[model samples]
Target: MQPTESKGLSSSIFISRCRAVWIHIGEMSCSSYKVKRISGFDPPPARVFAWRVLELKEQGVREDDAMAVADMEYRTQKKAKKKAYKELKEIARSEGKKPPPNPYPSAIKEIQAEEKKYVMDRLFNPKVIEIANKMKEERDKLRQDRAADGL
Candidate 1:
């Protein structure tokens, strides 16, 4: 690894050196060695958690409360779907028509619904995702500005 000029990536990056200038900052490079020299957390997990907790607290709800609300909504939707399906069955019986497929495939769909709830809670319960999205947009804007300025 030839020296760009003075500083190069840290030891962590030099452990596995690839010979291609993937980037150019100053003498910019993709060498992980200089990763510490880079600013900002690549991705912050604890920050996300803290943001989520703060967001929920501001909204006057705990995580369990949010999960309960989700479950209740799920149940309400299930009940409504069941009612509609039953009503369709009544109409079919009176009209001597074949009943449509069970609109409420709860038995089969329950797992999927549960899985969706799990994912939503795990990934989106807190406002961390929203915060992350906004941060990404801001960072992208900053990069664009820097690029425009020939930085």
Candidate 2:
């Protein structure tokens, strides 16, 4: 094989591999890609809520009514789960055994608790509120001073 022929043969092989990769990528369904993208980023609770609402809509429920119904159903299920866990804990206490671990521990609840604590400390605390008020007053006084100087 001459140098030129070998170069042509290698270039063809490279072009074919590139074409194969493009063809494989094109074979993937756009709808499936969109579904994967949505499901990947959306939280499970949000997906479940949307799914419930969709089911209600398919059953001829109005949009507003479907959302309300889905929210009510989700809250009811959460309350029932809490009550069942409480009952289980009480039974374990009465039997003098170690309480079973919570079967449905929620990261969302923990995050909310942390957020509440941060807000209470930084936003609602009397000292913090007083400091914020003082800063605002100083800013207002500075603005007034600047206006007077401009005048």
Which structure among the candidates has the greatest TM-score? 2
lDDT per model, in order?
0.54, 0.62
> What tens-digit string does per-residue lDDT give for candidate 1 at 1-151?
3445546532111211221112122434333222132356442323333333334434667656644554455468668988999999999989999989884465558788778976786586667678778899999999999999995
lDDT of candidate 2 over 15-43, digit per residue (tens): 13111111112222222222233545644
RMSD of each: 26.6, 15.6
Instruction: lDDT for model 2, please.
Output: 0.62
- For model 1, the local distance difference test gives 0.54
| Clash count of each predicted structure | 7, 0
Q: TM-scores, in order shown?
A: 0.33, 0.44
Clashes of 2: 0
